[model samples]
Structure formats: C-alpha cells, structure tokens
Target: MSPSVLLRWALRDSARGVTASWIGGLGYQAGLILLPWCLGRALDEGITPGDRSPLLSWAAATLAVSVALTGAEFAMRWWATLAGVRTGNRLLLRLSERVLGWDAVTAHRFSAGDLVTRGTRDVEQITIWISTVPSLASGVLGLFTVLVVVATLDPMLAVVGLGTVPLLIAVNLWYPRRYEAANAALSAAHGARADAVEDLLSASTAVRGLGGEQVLVERHHEASATVHDRTLALARIAAGWAANAPFVPWLATAAGLAFGGLAVLDGRFSVGGLVSFASWMTLLGRQVMMLTFRFGQLGDAWTAAGRIEAVLSAESEMSDKATSLLPAGALATDGVSVELPDREPLRLPDLSVGPGEFVAVVGPVGTGKTTLLRLLARLADPSTGAIRYGGTDLRDAAIADVRDTITIVGQRPLLLSGTIAENLRLGRTELTDGQLREACRIAGILEHIESLPEGFATEVGERGSTVSGGQLQRLALARGLLRGARVLLLDDVTSAVDARTEQRILDGLRELDVTIVFATSRTAVRDRADRVVDLGVHDGELVSHG
Candidate 1:
C-alpha cells in the first residue's frame, strides 16, 4: 500500500480517539493562548492604570484558563492513550491470526525470529507513535494558528517570533528518512541477535555434547557485535539530529529578538506586546519540535508496518479451494510425481488403500515415501498428477476440510507448550477420559504417565520440553489418535520408541483400517508390509514402482 494509505489506515481505526484528543487539545491550546493574552490585558488595563477591577478580572480569567487547560490535557492523555493501546492490541491479534492461517510452506519461507520481532517490537513501536500522533498533529496546527494571530496583532513582533520556525520545519522534513533507515537496520540486527541467542539456548545440550560450546559462543559474540555496531550507529544518528536541531533556530531567534529590542525601546512596540510575541515563539517552537519527533516515530512505525504487511500478505503454494467436501473415508494417488529444489524427479506409480485398512510401506531412507504421503495429506502439491478422496480430486476439495480429515504422525512431533492433557487434545474437545486413556495406551505412554505425580494433568513445559524424546513422541501419537482422522499417515513413528513399545503400538493400530500408509526404514517392520514401494537405482535409470 502507499504511504498515505498506511497513515490513514493506522490512525483511522481510532477515529473516536482522534476526535476526542483533538477536542481536548483545542481546550489545552486555548489556555496556552489565553495565558499570555490575560497577562498582557492585565498589564494594559489594570497594572498600568493601578485599577483593582482589571486585576481581579485578569486573575479570574487566568484561573479559569488554567483549570480548563489542566482538565483538557488530562482528558486528551487518557483518551488518546487508551485508544492507541486498544487499536494496537486488536491489530496484533489480527496479525497473529493471519500468521497462524499460513500454510506450512508459507511459514517456512520466513524465519521465526523475524516474526517475533514484527509481532512484538514492531507492533509496539507503531502503538507509541499512534498514542502521540493526534496530539502532535493538533499541536502543530495550534502553533501555526498562534503565529497567524501574532502576525495580525503586530507583524514585526510576529516575524521575530517565527524566526526559528522555518529552519525547524526543514529539519523535521529531512530527519525522518535517515532516522527510519538507521532504526530499520537496528531492528534487523536485533532479529539476528535474537535468532543466535535462541539457537544457542535451544541447542545447549548438542553444543556441549559435541564440545562446540566455544564455537557457539563465538558465533553468538559475532552476531552480538554486529547488533551492537548497528545499535551504536542508530544512537549516533539520533544524537546528530538532536544536536544539529537547535543551531539554526537559536541563531535566527537571537538575531531577530536583538533587532526587535531596539524597536521596543523606541516606543515602536509595547512591553506586554513583546512579552506576548516571545510567548508565541516559545509555544510555536515547542510544537514544531513535537511535530518533528512525532513524524520521525511515524516513519519508524511505517517501516515496521511494511515488513509486517509483507508477511501477512504472502500467498501459499497451494491456493485455496473453496469447495467443501462432505467427510469421506478414502485416499489414493495415481502417477504422483514430485521435483525437489535442485534434485531429479521422483515418481509414485500408483497407490490405493481402502478405508479402515492399515498398510505398511517399507523402503530405505530417501525413498520418497514421506514425500508421497505428504502429497496425499495435501501438505504439498503433486507435480503432474492428482491425489483423491473417494474419486474426487484433493486439490478441488476444501483445504480446511481435507486437513480436518487426516492427521500425520511424523517422526518428531512438536507439541505445544502446555499440560499433558492439553497438548493431547489440541483444540478438539470431543474426546472423553476413557478415549484419551485408550489413545495413550495405543501410543505406549499411559503406564509411563500414570507413574508421574500429576499423571495426565501434568504440565509438559514449553514444547513438551520437560519430557524425554520417547515420551514426547508418544504424546504426539496420542494427539493424532485423539484427532480420529479418516486417514492416518505414519511417517517413521517408530523411530524414537523401543522395539517393544513400537510393536505394541503397531499391534494396537492393526485392529482398525484408516487408509494407513506407514513409511519406515526399519528391518523389523519389513515383513509387516503387504506391498513394498522400491525407490532405488535399478539398472541404468532411477526407478520407483509399487
């Protein structure tokens, strides 16, 4: 989207706040304008003439304006702040929901670390800008209004008052681009550093086991240094702007006021008028500074919003199929083919399994068995042929419906961070206690969990981190069973468990037919297959035929 669209979209959501903030801002600036006016009026009418009536009127007006400004400032602060936070938080939730909607392939295209930054840091940066934006905009307009009034009252004093304004406006216009560039680089550095640190912590066991602690540390240090350098560069840029900002304004203001002072002494200007002009300059100068700062933050926020938009707007490899399929129990692939990023093509000549029929598929590693199963699951599209359900093309069916119909039991199942029971159920709430126990039994994890102090209700820690590899795998298996899919694709499910447990799991699954396509490299499972899909170099040509 264009920059104008971005600005309007960001602020328009908080329309009520924008209105409330400005109305209250008008009140605040009215008081600021009246403060000098009341002082000048008192000097001209009461203090100069020694009349108590003018003094009393000026004092009352001052008190009223003071009270109004205070109340208005408070209202604006609270109203704008709440609105910004609410809008930012709602947008963040929407962004996260969109992220979750992303398909596996789309998600893999971006780093998890970058996503974290966009969601948290980037969203917050924009929120802060929004909180201050309306008031800042209003304040700038107020300054301009005050300058016009001063010019009408007395042009010479007004010119002296506005001596610093043009220079300040120029600085404001020029500062944002450089500031945004520096901050964007800093954000990228921060993302890389976060990635490095997360990797080090996540793979601590591997690093220590491989005696590569020093290597990981060096890598982390390097990433940290890069981030540090970028951060320092941002600091330097901000500092340069801050220091150079006051130079032109002060020089112009000093020279104008010095010359204006002689006119005042020659009865060309009143004392109260001169004071009012100085007051206008101070007020306008502050507003100019606020506008500069506000716009700079808006620029940084815009940069962040653009990155977030890129991720949110990304398209999936498999486009959406809006046609919903009635739930059915069938799966098949005919002449399925797949091509890797840089590798030769692999083919699946034919495959069929009736509903509720458990079948084993045995092959050496890299036999394209897993790839074939994933295509059946619609995780990736087949290159040239179709996978079907009950003679209907899978690609033509509703994607959400298809996914709901099948679940894959992968080699390494990453469970969400939660309680054991929570991870097992995922989001489905239809499973009963008895059914859950049966699934755990089938997955060879029931007895193991019964021994724990909390049993099924135990917290599994982040990503099931508190559990061993075998245990986590069993938890994943239980999750799949709880899903009650019409088709179950077991891809090396036995890779992590002991032979006895594996045998128990296989024996339990044999009772039901769910169009199972079990992919394995295990010698023990070879004899269990009704058909073998060989994918190896046969003769001169590479071959794959079931």
Candidate 2:
C-alpha cells in the first residue's frame, strides 16, 4: 500500500466520526464569525446612538454564540480524538495480523525493534495528524468566511486584509517539503536507535560475560546521538516556520487597521464596520497560524504512512492455496534441498520414516539440522524438491493442518513472561491442570515445577529469565507436548540439560504414541533412534544408518 492508500483507508474506516467532527467544527467556526458581527451591531445601533435596548439585545446574542461555540469545540475535539484512535488501532491490528502470518523468509526483512516502532510510534504520528484534519478544514473555511464578511462591509477592507495572504501561503507551502525531509530523517534515526536499544537489552548477559559492557554501551550511545541530532534538525525547521508564517498575517492586520481607521474618520465607514473589519483581520491571522501547523503535521504523518506502507506491502514467499487436511502416515523427503545465506546449499538424500518410528538427524553445528526440522514442521519450505507426509506433498496440505499434526520445539524456545500455568495453557483454557502436569512429567519438568514455592503459579519473568537454560527448554518441551501432535520435531532441545535428565526425557518420549524426529549430535540420542540420518557423514548429502 502507498501512503495515499493508507490515508484513504484511515478516512474510510472512521468516516462517521470524521463527518461528525467536521459538522461540529463548522458550527464552532460559524459561532466565532457571528460574535464579532453581533458586537458591531450593538455598537452601531445602540451604543453610538446612546440607546440601551439594542446594546442589551446584542450582548445576549454574543453570550449565546459563545456558549454554543464552547459546546461545538468540545464535540469537535472529542469526535476527532475518537476517530484518530480507532483508525490507528485498526491499522495496528492489520499490521499485527500480517506479521503473525509471516514465514521465516519474510520475517528476516526487518528487525524486531523496527517492526515495534512502526507499529507504535508511526501509528501515533498518523493518529495525531488525523485528529488535526477537522481543525485544518474548518479553519480554512473560517478564513474564507472572514473574507466574505469583510467584502460585504467594504471591498477595500477585504483587499487590505488579504494583501499578504498569497505570500504567506507560498511560504507555508515551502515548509512542508523541508519539514517532510527532516521528519523522514528523524524517523529513520528513531528506528535505528530502537534497534540498538533492543540489542543492548536482549544481549546484555552475553556482553557482560565477554567483559564488553562498555563496548555495547558505546554503541547505544552512538545510536542515541544520531537520534538527538536528527531531532534537533527537525525542531529547528519547525520553530523557524512557526515564528515566521503567522508574522506575515499580522502585517496584513496592521495594514487593514490603518486603512479602516481612515475610512471611519472620513465617514466612508461606520465605527462598527471598522471594529468588525479589525476583528476579521485578527481571525485571519490566527487561522493562518493554525493551518500552517497542521500542514507541518501532515508532513510528519506522510513519512509515518510511508513506513507503515513498507510493513503492510511486504509479501510472503510461502504459498497458501492448499486447503486439504494432512493425512497421517510415514514421512519422507525426496531430494530436499535448502539454500543457506553465506553457506553451501543443504542437500538431503532420499529418506523415509515409518509411522510411530523414532528418527534422529545428527550433524555438526551449522550442518542444517535445525533447517531440516523446520522444513518437516512446515515452518519453511524447501528451496528445491519436496517433503511428503503420508504420500501427500507438504506444500499441498493446508499450513494449519500441517501444524495441527506436528509440533516443533526449537533449540532456543521462546517463553513469554507469565505464570507457569498460563504459559502451558497458551489460550487452551479447556486443558485441565492434570493434563498440564502429565505433559510436564513426560517432558521431565514436572518435578521442578512442583518443587517451586508457588508451584504452577510461579512467574517465569521475561523470556523465562528466572529459570535456568535447561529448565526453560524443558518447560517449552512440556508446552509442545501438551499440543498432542502426531509428529514431534526436536531441535537439540536436550542440549542444555544434564545427561541423566536427557536420558529421562528420551525414555518418557519413547513411551508416547507419536512419531519423533530428533536433531542432535549427542551419542545417547542417536544410539536410541530406530534410524539416524547424519548430515556431517557425507559432503553436501545426508547418510542414514540403522
């Protein structure tokens, strides 16, 4: 989606609120225009002639307009804010939905921090801009109202009031181009700084272990400096424009007052007409300032919209046409291959595993063990050739169906910050505590959880930081087991555990009525497998041994 399309989507989604806001804004502007006219009428018909009746009537009219304007202003702002927030949240939801559907190949296009910034800060920018739209529109119409009112009183006064307007508008127009460039630079700096901060937080432990905390801190500081510099650049441009844009309208106001005073003295204009002309000139100046500021906001929003477009427009490489349910049977790979970044392609020799068999894929580090598991789990597709489950091509089955029958536990599993029970349940609220405990027992994590002070209610901290690496791995395994998938793919899940615990997990897994595909280099795991496929045993090819 382009920036224009994104803007149209926002407007279309919140049309009712935006329409109501526009109506309220027009009401407010009409009241504002009437106030000065009412005061002028009182001055001419009553105050000048020393009659109190006309003056009193106009005073009540002015107060009534003021009250109505107050209510209209409230409605305008309330509806505008509601519309903006609603549109922003809708855009955020769409972005999240797209991101969740991304395959591994599509996921690598942006950093986690970049995506976060686009979803949050960029959305906020667009929301603020949307909120300003009603005011900008009403203010422009108000300026014209002032012009028409002045022209009715005296065309010469209208000329005086608008003498500098064209020039002021040209200057205002020039500011957006410059402001947009500065805003875009600032946005990019913000994304980079966010990425640096994310890295510092996620890898703080590793940097401390390497005794390179200072190095990481310096890197973050550099990123911060760039953001600061870009921010200052944008602020300077905005400040200069704000200070200058409204000043020209003031010059027009001074000219209008001078000419109007002469006309009033010469009896060509009434005292009341001069007062109304001066009031209209003041309104024009204020409107110029407001509209210019809104235009600047538009520049910032355009930059944000472009960034949002980048995220929404990214297409996934994986196909999603398959709707067939995956059948249960043997799993096999036919000349499956995957191209690796900065490495040789992984080529798997033809292999087959019968139903309910335990198979192990063994290889040295970086030998594509995890890649093969990912392919089998359908987390990604093979670059060439195909894998089949029960004689049906993996790509020909619906992804949801594939995932329903297979569960994969990665080497570094992600555990959200929550209670132990919540992590295990993962929205499957129907699963009882007994089922959770039984799954944990099979994964060799039940004893550990029961020994905790809070038991299943214990908080796991962010990414399971409170737990040891081995314990985190076990918890993830337990969670995967609770899925009750027919096939389980393990990617060195037992690497962090002790030998005894690893053996215990393996023994428990053997008793389950599920197909097991384990990827590991440990001798114990391969020895227990019905068959072992070792990628390291052959150059660019997998070799199976029984």
CA-lDDT, candidates in order: 0.75, 0.86
Specify the poorest-scoring 10-residue window by lDDT in model 2: 537-546
Among the numbered candidates, top TM-score falls to 2
Q: After superposition, which runs of candidate 1 have C-alpha atoms over 4 Å from their true positions?
A: 1-7, 42-57, 103-105, 246-264, 427-438, 511-513, 522-546
lDDT for 495 in candidate 2 is 91
Give the distance in Å from residue 322's predicted Cα in candidate 2 to where it truly belongs: 2.9
lDDT of 2 at 49: 62
Judged by lDDT against the true structure, how good is candidate 1? Answer: 0.75
- Candidate 2 TM-score versus the reference: 0.93
Model 2 lDDT per residue over 1-546, tens place: 669889888888888888889889999999889988987887888574656787788888889999999999999999999999999899999999889778987989998888988999999988998888898889889988887787788777777665666878788877888899999999988888888888889888887878777777888999899999999999999998887887886887787778888888889998888887778777777877788889888888899999999988888887765666455688888889998779788887677777788989887887788988999988899989898888888888877788888899999998898999999999899999999999899889999999999999999999998999999999999999999898999988999999999999999899998899999978889888888887876643443556
